[model samples]
Target chain A: MDAWFQNEVTYPHVAQEVLDAADSVRATLPNKYCDPEIAANLFAEAIDEYLLCDDLGINVICTEHHAGINSLLASNPMLLSILASQTKNVRILSLGTLITLRPDPVRVAEEYATADVLSRGRLEIGFVKSGLSEYASNQASPIDNGDRYWEAIDLISKALSHQEGVFSWEGKHFTHRHVNIWPRPYQPTLPRMWSATGDPSTAGDVGRRDMVQVLVLRGPEGTKTAFAANRRARAAAGMPKPTTDRFAYAALVAVGDTHEEGVRMGEKLMWFLNTSLRSAPQFGPKLPGLAPPQAAPGLYRTKPAAAKPGETASAAANAAALMNITAEQAMARGIMFAGSPDTVHKQIMDFHEAVGGFDHLSMIGRSGFMTHAETSKSMTLFGKEVLPRLKEVKTVTAGYNQPD
Target chain B: MTNATALPASGNLLIGDIELEVVRRGVGQPMLLLHGFQNIEPDAPFLDMLGDHASIIAPSHPGFGRSSRPKDVETVYDLVHCYLALLDSIPDEKVSLMGFSFGGWLAAEIAVKAGRRIDRLILVDALGIKISGPETPDIFDVFNKHPDEVRKRSWHDPAAQAPDYDALSDSQLANISRNWEALCRYGWHPYMYNPQLKRWLGHIKARTLVLWGASDGIVTPAYGEAYARLIPGARFETIDAAAHHPYLEQPRAFVDRVSRFLKS
Candidate 1:
């Protein structure tokens, strides 16, 4: 079972004084008044944390978001390249790059391929339609996002594939001539491709493409249903049935010596969820044209509806709903896994049983305003006690997908 | 004045792969009325008013209203060619052309491309030219404002601005959303203005009247004047006590000025 950690370099020092100063001037300061020095440290610290995870048999997944207070990581390719250089053996996944927002596909192809070569075939290309906020910030028309994303993926995939001779692309959203990518990927074929979404409708599309489907923010039942539907679609496509290896889930996690310490540490994840999730509503106005007309409302409701007044309410509600549970509720619901090493291990096993088991467990380690030492302790404990005990557990969905 | 309304004959005109919904009324010289980004209803009072004069051919731009928008029709240039085809198909050898807001920009584009087919041109607060002086707010600002705030900028009488959204049918709502999406497809990239449009404005030889709402904040009257100055023989006129849509706010004045210009 490959373990992965998804992280963003969130701004470190969000002082009330700086916020007050910004509010006095009536300026909505960029990135929650992030001090550049603090942000720089956070970036370096995040890389170091990933390096630590490397030592612990955990792979790294770097993702991107735009114009948000919490997320300081806006460029996935740039971060992934750095990860490629710093880490060895551990796979580096963008999990994904915002494909829809990118204006140039050739550049994306070149950058990711470079990273793949740098890592010597230990890279996965994850493409995402991204969120509405990115489209708005980049001033790209939201209505064309789906079309643009699919077109971009096609262009990038072909560019990376080891097709001999020069090729050209003529897509509705992009057109390029003389397309021979230099420094082709280390792998003969393109690296593994991933499509991340909360939308069930995309399951068939992802399955048809034979790409891994990474489910985000979906609870156990939802994950199971989505995975089953994807498997069914692939089977219907006459492709091999999908295994748990073809699926991955993201969860907020913390581990400690005792349940009480775990719970206390888990509060930091709740803070991260609430504060980071609050920016979700601002993505709506930006998505007017991005989503299909009927699907627009679903995009907003992707998270739990919020209680706080105005835009942040839905995001806050989503966070609160996810984290407000008792440990028992958490275990049953599979919303989060936070406890002692034994408890956390059992909870993961139970979740695996419930969802029919997925291959990758993506832990969000450094969340909210949690201190480095606290997250470091959680990581150390997870590596020391949790991972070793689970080594003997057999793959649950292995061989479900027949090999090509 | 007749209390009864005369419903225009509606039909679909197949221009290549596109099926354009066209409404025509009153037999005379053909006068094509192109609607704004937010399309006017088929039975809008202004259409009825125009129906009393020249033969009115009001067709929704492709991807708007009941029209079929083919994927091939991606840019404003595609729309211009489509309108040109519509012009050629009409019985009149030379037809008067009038377009509102986005439609006005289309009319201007058409005039620049094929001005010989246009006998006269009228642009009502068109949104497709970039001006340097007296900073003009991008038409995309309407998307950022509250619907009511946008309403205030769109009408002289605020009472006329309140749309009972609940009363609208599902199709009406869908059409409204589709209209905005189409606008985004055509104008969102360059932000509602064609940067190269100014260069081609000199090519338009049709006797033109560039109309504006005197109090229009959507695109200032100064912007309208700049639009008029580009055309060699175009006249500029601003209707008083109105915002963006003078035809909706002050119908009689709008019809009178437009009719007088087309006649002269």
Candidate 2:
């Protein structure tokens, strides 16, 4: 389960008009209602609660996003390093360091390697090709995102593992005469790698290289197909068959004492989903040359067919459709799991049955305008009841409760 | 050649590995028309009106309209070199070069490098110079706007008919997409203007005409004025009741202004 130290000062106080005008999810709402002083307090409270999750035997997931208040935290490595120092045994999954945006992949290798060493090798690196808004804000072209990501990963891997100590890289996106890093890695080999994406081929792309696949909000059917494709790709590449530990599913999760309490918590999660995730991550920003010609439509969920007469499915229409998904619909489709611990447990088991067993269940324990007290309660309940119940349940594919 | 009243003969003119769709009409001193970012319809009314004065040689910019976009022709610098090669390939000693908006920027760039090759240079509603005073509208802002807002800001007629994008064939849509990408490739870095271009304005020797549309919210008439002020002996004129595409909006007046200048 992941505990996000989200900026919650004005979460409950967000005006109706702010949410209404947040049509693209990229638009920044006025921060007049927000008090920056409360942010430090919020972070402190989250840190104490997340340390509690560590004590209760739960591995925490950390991720990154930029520019907007949608995710106030943008530096994953910085956050993870702080968590690593704060805790003793809890594993910190840096659910990603964005590979595509890095001007220097060597810096990425150095930063995460330092984090891994500081954590005494408890860090799991998740490499992400960040969302389009990140590209837009950074002035990085989305057109070159795919190639840049692949190139960055390749260079970072070689930099981390090269026995020769110093090497040169002359790739299409990056070129360095001397590719070497100090304090190579805490682990004997390069640290465990993960790639999170909605595209099915990404699962295979990672699987072929023995990296874990972090399946994002893609639904159950899509997950099943993605997993199968991954297995096939690994086999085709002559790599050993992927175990269930090689897959992880991320979902918006909340647990309460009662089912009704969980639903109440879900209202906040729904707000986050409805407003922040509305237009962004809906269809990728359509930067030209971002994807290959054939991969373009799938990469960016190109314009959907119009539901209304004479109102063609323009960019605005697509954003409207994304914002239209109700919490109930999301729960019914297994996109979210919000209920009592027992209810959430059942949904997880059901998801495991549908897409085979995956050891890591990346949970969004807190979202929307959830307070520190409420979010801590949810995390505590999940770690106490849910984590213990799922400990013995062997992954159907790998027959292990945790990765080797 | 057909009578001056007849429309231009349009065909693909392969220049080396690249093929540009060129439209030639009338017969007299060569008057080259470098179109702006948008597609130049072969039989546009304004082109016909201009054809009455001098031979109109209109070629679609690479990666625009039906022209073949070689991967090598990616930047404004590349375009300048390509066009220079194109001028050398032709037998004409000199040609009158006129450009609108994006093409106007290209014309200015060419004139700076090789002004001797052009007999006259005309720029209309051009965007390539950065002024120091008030902040100008970012040309990239057009992408952020709704198509309706873009059209309203770009033209005097808010209801002006545009290509029915939804009804366009896949190939046509692809061409628009290509042109847009090429535009990004060319203009995304310096953001529609060269930082040092102002220094080179003194090198231009051709008789220069700077035209503008009074209502051009895209670049604003002030942008046009600043551009003309920099060029030596350049004459600046504004057409009433028009915006970015003055030729499209006020064809008769636009042609009359250009014809009078060329004949002078």
Say which candidate scores most in lDDT: 1
State each model's TM-score restricted to chain B. 0.91, 0.89
Question: Which portions of model 2 miss their true places by more than 4 Å?
Answer: A1-13, A21-33, A163-170, A175-179, A201-204, A235-238, A278-303, A306-322, A393-404, B1-10, B70-73, B133-140, B144-149, B161-174
What residue runs in model 1 are displaced by over 4 Å at the alpha carbon?
A12-32, A163-165, A279-282, A294-333, A396-404, B1-9, B25-27, B133-138, B142-162
Clashing residue pairs, candidate 1?
A142-A289, A142-A290, A143-A289, A143-A290, A306-A313, A306-A314
Question: Model 1 chain B: which ten-residue window has the lowest total lDDT?
Answer: B1-10
Candidate 2 at residue A152, lDDT? 93
Full-model lDDT for every candidate: 0.74, 0.71
Model 1 over residues B51-152: C-alpha lDDT tens digits?
677888888899888899987788998888888777767656788899889899998988888768788999998888888743745563555344456677
In model 2 chain A, the worst 10-residue window by lDDT is: A1-10
Q: A246-330 in candidate 2: lDDT tens per residue?
A: 8888777778899879867866776665766544332243455443333333333345444343222322333345455776677
lDDT of 1 by residue, A1-404 (tens): 66788667665366656544432111134654667888787888888888888888778899887766557787888889888988997888887778788788988999988999888888988887775445556667767776787889999999999469799887788989779988898888889998876455576678778888877656675666666667767878898666667777778778889977886787666655544444334344423564444432333325433332211122223444664454445545676688899888888877777666677787877776777787878888998898887665656553343222
Error of 1 at A161 (Å): 2.6
